[model samples]
Target: MRILVILRRVLDPAGIVAHRRLRRLFINREEYLIQPGDHSALEAALRIKDLGGAEVVVVSGQPEPDDDTVCRGLAMGADGAIYLSGEGFAGADDGVAARLLQAVVDRLGGADLVLVGMTTLDTAQAQLGPRLAGALGWPQIVGAWSVEIVDGRVRAVRRDGDDYVVVETDLPAVVTVPGRALEPRYPDGARLVNVYRGEGGMGEAVLRWDVADLLHPEGLVPLLENRGRDFPPERELGVRVEGTTEEVAQAVAEALRARLRGA
Candidate 1:
């Protein structure tokens, strides 16, 4: 079986500070990590590869530097990695990304399965997987908690109200996993060193493809545009109720009622 996993990079929120008073975000350290949702998706792909002996190919979900996320995927037991980059790919939105990925699927001669994160950490946009599924004309299971392949179909567990329900789809389908649903294994020390240093016949496993080659001029247009950022109003100090017990209780109840009504 041929399985494709999509990966993305995100800035570490701990390394940044948001100043509401100043209405600005400051980056103390510019460190990047794999998107948490995509990390879980990678773990799912690795588990499938381990059980069924499938070829796991990791691909970048957006245009980025090849050295970070791609190398990490290699060290995490992916059979191959592909970095998609080009001038045309810059600032491409979810719609353009999905179209470009569909072209990649065609260039790779199709795949048996595709896995991606249900939502992005930074933007919280969940359109990529669904859009890609529509472009490929394949079935999709979104917000999956767990996934497995049985017989000739893909079985996934997802939340429905308070219960977890099993959903099934045919082969050549897309599955989007929720963040932190599965714990990702640590990368192998030797493999990590080799992949970073480009040694042990593994250097050729990571390939770079240009977005211009995969997409047309019309397909490169982004659907979303960036408006200016908005900041919430600053917080105010809490009011203190000073009186006898009955009076304080009455004030508290009235405050609660007012807050609920406002809500």
Candidate 2:
């Protein structure tokens, strides 16, 4: 079976967002951190690769598909990488982005399953995953925590509201993996460092995709815009002390009861 994993560039979530103080900075925004969903997708995709039965392919959005990026994906365990890069598609928003990605799928067209991160690092709206699936007319199992391939069918575990979910689907399906669903193996440094130096290396690895390549009109729709933001001052925290173990328990119970009564 062939599995295609869609990797994306994301801002690290642990980092704090900074105020855009420099006008010349490249794409600076107040929300500078990558969302958690992107990490989840990468981790999940990597897990599928490590399991060993399928050939894993990685795809990304860039103006030109880079050999270095492909090497990195290989280091992370992908068999190969596909970059859907170009000029007109550079500023495409999520909807437009989906159109571009769908074209990549059509162009690269041979896969039993396609896995994507739940959301991109920059945009946490979690829109692209499902949209891409819809555009491709594929069955999608969103927010899967775990997936197993058996006899060309997929058995996936997912989150459903407060409950968990498990579903079985046939091949040629698109599944959006949830955040940190599984651990992504560390890059194989020794092997990756040598992939480029090795014989017959990404000989001429590059794909130049233009918006005109797609069946859709070359229209760029803005996925997001900042109308405004509200800054709420941090609320002051307070602490209360209860006399003894018994007294503290009593106080907590009384407070809870009183709050519930009011509600």
Candidate 3:
């Protein structure tokens, strides 16, 4: 069985500062880190590989010439990596990415499973996995905490409201893992250095793919465009109801009723 894991890079939040008073964000240092959710997904994939025998491949759409994210996946025990690049993908949105990824899956001769992050760190957008699932017409299990393969089926532990439940789907399904679901293992030190130096047989593990060859220019056109950033207004402090229990309950009920009426 072959499992494909999607990885992405995000700006390090520790290197940036957000000012509510000025309503602006400042980047003190330009550094990138693997998306937290994607990191967890990678860990999940690696765990699955450890359980049995499965080829794990990592794929990324980050710009070329900088294969840091994909290479890191290689050092973290992925069997192979695919780096996607092209001018048309510069401003590609989730919709365009979904199409591109769909093509990648087909070009790979298909995979038994596809694992990815439940949401992106920077945008907090949870559309990619669902969009890809829709594009591929595959069943998706979102926000998986644990994953396992049993009898040609994929089983995962997921949260339902405040409860946890086990859900299973057939092979060739999509699974989105939450950021805090698992702890990511450190990359192999020697492999990490070797991958960057193009030595120790790690150089050939990365394959560069041009998006143009995968899809037409028209197909690369993004469905969404970034206009600008909008910051929320200053937050107002909440009212405090310090009284007897019944009085506090009454106050809370009145507040909710008022809010509902206003809505």
How do the predictions measure up, each by TM-score?
Answer: 0.92, 0.72, 0.89
Off by over 4 Å in 3: 234-263
Clashes of each: 0, 3, 0
Kindly report which residue stretches of model 1 are placed more than 4 angstroms away from their true locations once superposed: 61-64, 241-263
- Model 3 Cα lDDT, one tens digit per residue, 114-158: 999998889999888889999999999999999999999999999
Worst 10 residues of 2 by lDDT: 25-34
Superior by lDDT: candidate 1 or candidate 2:
1
Candidate 2, residues 138-176, lDDT tens digits: the string is 888888888877677878898878999889888788888
Our model 1 lands, by Cα RMSD against the true structure, at 2.6
Tens digits of per-residue lDDT for model 1 on 1-263? 98899988889989987778899889999998898888899999999888878899999845655478988998999999988988778788889988988998999999989999999998899998999999999999998888899997899999999999999999999999998789999999999999999998679998789888988888899988898777776788988899999999999999999999999
**Candidate 2: RMSD to truth:** 5.3
Clashing pairs for predicted structure model 2, backbone only: 11-34, 40-179, 40-180
Task: Supply the global lDDT for candidate 3.
Answer: 0.91
Error of 3 at 113 (Å): 0.6
